[model samples]
Target: MLGSIPDLLRLLAVPVFGWAAYRDIETRRVPNRTWAPLAVLGVVLLLWDTYAVVTGPTSGRLFFVQVAISLGFVAPLAYGFWLIGGFGGADAKAFMLVAVLFPAYPTYYLQTTALPLEPSLVGVFSLTILSNTVLAGVVYPLGVAAGNLVRGRFSWAMFLGKPVAVERLPEEYGRLLEDADGFTRSGLDLDALRMYLQWRGASLSELRAAPDAHRNPDSLPADPNPPGDGSVVTDGGVPASGSPDQFGTAGTADPWGAERFLDDVEGSAYGTDPETLRAGLELLADADEVWVSPGIPFLVPMFVGLVAALVYGDVLYALLSALGLA
Candidate 1:
């Protein structure tokens, strides 16, 4: 019964990791609500397993010792990664939960075949998953490098990135990998400011309609009077009635029309927190096209790691043995 319970629980992990990977890919954010149920389930099963082991056999004490070692080692290691920005909150929580769920290899699933190495090397399921995850992560960069080489743009530092038109940048799919060449303003977080603008319904067309509007009506110079309705104005003293095409068209040297539209929005909305707005505008002005890296949604790799641990045991152990190094 104890053996079957962990096997079933290990199967349960597939759906949980799948959902997390899907949500991470789509939104780049994982809600705590997703992890909570899995954590609870893992904890309950862990306690039940602990009870069964303690009551069962001479090897029961060894089971408890393995649990201690797995939890003691993995929990702090996950926390350290979180502290160093190597792992996101959700990723760290998932790793620790994995230690709780599968304190030892799910041996019931390994009925006929033995691991390539002595079981001691990957006694803990969490350690096996971590090793698989690291191997998978390394493969990703090599794939990126190969693609860059094929494209004839083989720079060592930039092999993982591709140039993208600013207008084509998805709201959250990729991160701007390079700083704007000539842009120097610093204060607010540009990413947050972009999110704020979208939330406020301050669209590009609306900002283009009145480029000189400021959040504060008093900041306008004498040349550009605030519209009677108190709409924000641009910094260049341009009123709302000006032409939208003043910012330039797409695919040209001055192909930052969208950015300039955003700049007007920032200038109009610029208030006590103008520094962030200024920094964002400067970043936009840095280049016509910017290098962006489609960031690896970590949950995808976590999911892969879980699946690999179940089917292959420790991948590194298998590889080393196959190469005659083990």
Candidate 2:
């Protein structure tokens, strides 16, 4: 009965994490509603499972101790990652949920043959999941580096990211890879740009008003929305269905229909107001290209790590064994 409950929870968690990852990829935000219920259900299932198998004083004590260690250790570690910006809020919460739901590997899902590692290490499912996640995450950068080399885009930052036209920047999930630089600028500090824009009195609205001069003409996305017919594509590429606005028409406040393209550029952490947009425009005025890092949502890798942990057991143990160090 104890075995069946965790196994069932594992089945439930996969789809939930899968959906969360999908949502994160599209919108870069996962609703708290999605996680809250999963968290509650995980706790209830874990408690019931623990109760079902607490046969006597010794076994009950062992179960309680494991629970304490899982909560005490994993919660702090996840919270630390969040505080340090190593993981996002959603990612941290997901880790805590996994620690509660499957503090150890679900043995019933595995083969009859014993796991290669010592039983103690196999039991800490959250640790194994974290290890697997980190290992999987490493592949992305390596792949990016290899692709950059193949395309002759080699540079100091090529491994980290490539340049995209400012207008082509994805509003949903991209970060300015650069701090700040411009010929008219004395400092590369983001705050300095903010102050400069304040001094100049350049507003995002004014920049939006004159899109042709500031925005890259060559980088403009081809208007998929027909004039006065189809849904208007906003700056974030979200369709303004049935709205009056249309792309690539003349005499509109934004002629290029490029308002949505600069949404993130305007509201970046560098600054969220008009000054940030002015700063971005200044940087663009001095350079043809700007580097932007692909904003990877952490939930994507966590879900992958969970599946990997289940199928492969402990990633570190497997690696050590292969290296003849275990």
lDDT string for model 2 (89-124, tens) is: 788899888888877556543445533233335366
Q: Where is the poorest 10-residue window by lDDT in model 1?
A: 224-233
The worst-scoring run of ten residues by lDDT in candidate 2 lies at 224-233
What C-alpha lDDT values do all the predictions have?
A: 0.60, 0.58
Prediction 1 global C-alpha lDDT: 0.60
Best by TM-score: 1
lDDT of 1 by residue, 1-326 (tens): 23476567667888989998898787666788887888889888888887777777666766776688779998789989998867878889888888888788775434565432334364777888888888887787778778777877644335556666654442435545555342222222324434333433343334334544423222222232222212222232323333222234233332223334334445443231444444433454434665556667788887898887776678888788889998
